[model samples]
Target: MSFIASIGQGAINLYHRIRWVVSISTAIVQLAFHPSSWTKPVRAVLTRQIVFTGYDAIGFVAVVALLTGISVVVQAQVWMGRLGQSELLGPLLVTVIVREVGPLLVNFIVIGRSATAMAAELAGMKVRHEVEVLDSQGLDPLVFLVMPRAISMALSVFGLAMLFVVFSFGSGYLCGAFLGTGPGDPGIFARSVVRGVSSYDFYNILAKTLIPGLLTGVIAANEGLSVEGVATDIPQAVTRTVVRATLAVLVVSVIVSVLTYI
Candidate 1:
């Protein structure tokens, strides 16, 4: 009976957590569309969030993309050539890089780098009572804090995913050419990739990036703000932010992928 009760309690807690995150996400989406929500202060927060989460992440993301391209793209080219199915190289690369790997890896990177930082920052603010202070000053914390961050994350993830695809393809092509694994002509490689892409690929990347990014931001903010006045809880909040946000990103990715097939 004791073991059963513990399992039941854990299930209840999980349900509540999911409900809370979903409610916060819905509120964020609604506030995002309201013109009044984009006040000067909010705009500033959004801009800073974008720079911190997106612009600053470019170098690291580019390096990862390049390495991934060198490995995945070169191997695909070599194998396709071996099998005398070189023509299918473009479609296979597109399916792997654009449809699957690109968005997923970028989101994981952002979750590790930016999302953890955002959670810790907000948790610190909560411990300092800064959130209460802002609330007392007639500033809605949701508008001044959560909304902009969430919106910025969505935009940042989308931009970074696009960059990831481009960098990966460029690096892969160059590396393959140097290794004599790819076609001698650059135009042929470019055309192969372009031919592989369809309208669904665009939608797939967009959904995978923006939705997961938005949910990740919301999860970070929610976990951070859930911290009580105790300073000791801050670390725990940050940990939860990473765990929950990662799960959220994976869930969204799986759903989107399945929907694409259906």
Candidate 2:
């Protein structure tokens, strides 16, 4: 009886979370497409979000990507040579660096940096009744606040993923040249990369990056907005946002990887 009761309670909790996710996701979509949501004040909010989430993330993302690239180049040279497939260095780099590592790392960074911050900020507003104050003032908080942050966050993550790809792959190329991977021939490196990464790979990586960004932003916004009562709720919301964002990204990445093959 005890086990059965526990199972039922777990399902009930899951159902509530699913409902919240669906409701907030629909709200974000509606506001994202609604032109009325983009007034002057909202635009200012959006611009600030872009600056904070996107521009601020660039330096760290670049450094991480560069380091990854350098490591990949060294490994690719050794492994490919041992396999007697040294000519496949570019393709190996493309697959490991661009397809998997780049998107995953950028998404992780954004979740840690921006998602937690957004959750705490929104929770703070809620705890202070500022969101309710906006309600009384005849402004929809969704339009005034949440949706812009969601959209900006998604864009920021996507932009950062691109930066990751460039710096990581570019650094890998430089590493290869320095180590004479192609015996000082850049053409070999270029051809391998081009041949290795197909149009399908391009589309798949984009989907992986874009979808996760949108989901992370929406989930973080939802968690923050759901906070109710007390000073302690803010920290709790922030922690939940981080955990949920990490799990959501992992699930979405797995689904994309499977769907691409199908």
Candidate 3:
């Protein structure tokens, strides 16, 4: 009987996991098809997300990018000086900013700042029965709430990523010039930016930012929807949502990198 009970519990857990996946996937597909779900009023949500995720978080991202750029330049100069190929700094800086740092810094900022707040806010609403209240009024909670947040997150991430690239490259250039280790040619930097990044890389960057935003938004919403029982469950749901979303983003990023490169 104990063995049977254990097996039953495992089956139930598997069933719940599957249900969560299916429900979130269905919600995403439904939102994609329903343009009205993300219409005008939803623009407010997008604006809000941009303010919080992009503008407010810019300081942290800027500091990190500046330091990273400086370090990259310093290390590259040391190594390239030994190798007699110091002229390669332009291409190297362009590659680092475009291919790696830009997307990564954007992801870290969004996941830490916006994604966690979104999960907690939705979970709190669920605990307070606000979502149910919306549902009782015949409003589709997924369309009204979830879709706006998802769309806003995706747009904000893409925009912020582009900003990060520009800022990081500019910072790197200035710092390298100050340190006397730079290529010292803005024209070369501009040309490298134009030539080094292909259409496919842009598409991959877009997908990386947008898909993770969607996944984080949808997963957080689903976790909120799953909240049941006492008030404590709300925080628990938020925590679970964050952990799951972060893991999902990391896994998806790796897969995207592999698929894009390999």
Candidate 4:
């Protein structure tokens, strides 16, 4: 009975945590669309977050994309060629890279790199009572701290995911051509990939990136802010941010994939 009771308690805790994150995510979106929320300070913070989460991480993201393209794209091309279904290469790559891999990888990278850092930074601020300090100065912590960071995360993820798709496809094409695995003609390869894309793919990519990115940002911020002014708990908060954000991304991705089919 004790074991069952503990399981029930854990389930309840999970439910409450998810509800809180969703509620905060909705609030962040609402605040983001309000014209008055765009104060100079808020804009500055948003810029900094973008630079940190998106721009500075470009090189790393590109390298990962290049490697991924070399592996996944090249393999798809080679297999399609062997199977005498070279025509399917474009659709296969589009499905694997654009509809799935690109967004998921970019979101994971942002969560591991920027989200963890954001959580730690916020947790440190909470531990030092800086959040309270801002509150004392007539600044709402949600608007001054959370809103900009969360919005920037969503924008950054979407931008980086687009770049990932482009870079991955380009690297895959070049690698395939050099290795004699691809069609070898740039025009043919371009046309094939272009033919494979459709309007649903555009919506698929958007839903996967923006929704999960927003949820990830909210999870990180909420965990960071949940710290009770204890320095020792900051590390725990960062860990929770990573775990929760990763789960949120996966759950959102699976839901979007299902809805795309429906």
Candidate 5:
């Protein structure tokens, strides 16, 4: 009986994994074919998401970026000073901000603010049977609900990343200048950024932001849609969704970065 139970559990796990894959694939195909779903109404949702995920969180992003830039510039200044290559500060700051820190930091902010809230909201909708009601009314919940959030997240991430670059560069320059670093020139930093960041870099950053946005949206929606049993399940599902979404974003980011480098 124990062996039988173990086998049954394994089968259930496999079935869930298969269902998750099928659900995601179906949503992707549906989204691709139904461009009209992402219209004006969707734009409204996206706007709301931007307000919540971008505008509301701007202060936090600014503070974090400021500290991060200050830290990096100080460290870079010290290292460059030792090597007598202080002029490398501008290029190094640009490269670090554009290639790595910008995306990572923006993602962190989104995960903390937007993704988790999305999960919780959807989970609550699930708990309250709102999602089912929409479905029963012949409304496509993915279109009416999930797509907007996904688009918003992608656009917000891109916007926030750009903002982060600005804040980081500005703060870094100010901090370096205060510390008597001669190479912390904003003009040089701007030139290095223009030179170092190509179209390919922009494409890479967009891909990173877009994929993670989609993943977070789908994962949160799935978790919300999967809620069953007790009322406590809603919070549990939200927690799981956040964790899974965050992991997925990290994994995809690394894979894309590696592929881009290759």
Candidate 6:
């Protein structure tokens, strides 16, 4: 009977989590359609979120992209050399780096940085009864809080994903100059990479990046706003935010990839 009760509670908890995610997603869309969701204070917050999630994160994203690009390109060159498939290098880079790695890596960085912070901040506000205070003031917390974040994070992720892919392409080209056959013809390599990517591929990448970014804010907002009880609950919310957002993004990435690739 005790075990049965625990199972029932677990099922209820799962239902609530799913419901929270849906609520925040719906709130984001509704808030976007509202006029007051873009007031001066909220605009300022959105700008700050972009600065933190997009601009400030560029250094780490670039470094990771560079390393990944260099390593993957170098290794591809070596294997292709042995297999006599060196010409495929450009397509390989485009498919792997531009389409897949760029979007996933940028979102992962944002998940680690902004998602955790968002969860904790919201949780902190909740514990302090700030949300209730806002409610009493006739403020719709969803509009005042969640919408800007969703817009900023979505735009930021898309921007950062582009930056990451550009850096990855640059790094791959640089590595190709020394490691591959192209010693002094960077333009040729660039053209090759370009030819490898199709229009559908570009749209697919954008879809993947945009969805993850939007969902990330939603998941973080859900986790953060759902926090209850003591200060200890904040850490758990933060953890859930990171774990859930990352998993959600990865799942979305895979689904997008399958559809795009097919």
TM-score (all chains, Cα) for each model: 0.97, 0.92, 0.83, 0.98, 0.84, 0.90
Ranking, TM-score, top scorer first: 4, 1, 2, 6, 5, 3
Structural RMSD, model 3: 3.4
> What are the per-residue Cα lDDT tens digits for candidate 1 across 168-201?
9999999999989998699999999999999999
For model 3, the stretches where C-alpha displacement exceeds 4 angstroms are 1-26, 29-33, 39-41, 86-91
Tens digits of per-residue lDDT for model 5 on 94-149? 66777678887788778878777787788788778888898897667877777777
Query: TM-score: which candidate is best?
Result: 4
Candidate 1, superposed: residue stretches over 4 Å from native: none
Q: Could you give candidate 4's per-residue lDDT for residues 84-178 as a string of tens digits?
A: 99898898999999999999999999999999999999999999999999999988989988988888899999999999999999999999999
Q: Work out how many backbone clashes candidate 1 has.
A: 0
lDDT of 1: 0.93
Name every residue pair that clashes in candidate 6: none
- How many clashes in each structure? 0, 0, 0, 0, 0, 0
Per-residue accuracy of model 3 over 154-213 as CA lDDT, tens digit each: 777777777777777777678767777765677865674566566767777887788777
Tell me which of candidates 3 and 5 scores higher on TM-score.
Answer: 5
C-alpha RMSD by candidate, in order:
1.0, 1.8, 3.4, 0.9, 3.5, 2.4
Model 1: what TM-score?
A: 0.97
Residue by residue across 72-180, what tens digits does model 2's lDDT show? 8767876787889977877777777777788889999999999999988888888899999988987788787787887888788889988998887778778867876
Best-matching candidate per lDDT? 1
| Candidate 2: pairs in clash | none
Global lDDT of each candidate: 0.93, 0.82, 0.73, 0.92, 0.75, 0.83
Clash pairs detected, candidate 3: none
lDDT of 1 at 150: 89
Error of 6 at 14 (Å): 4.1
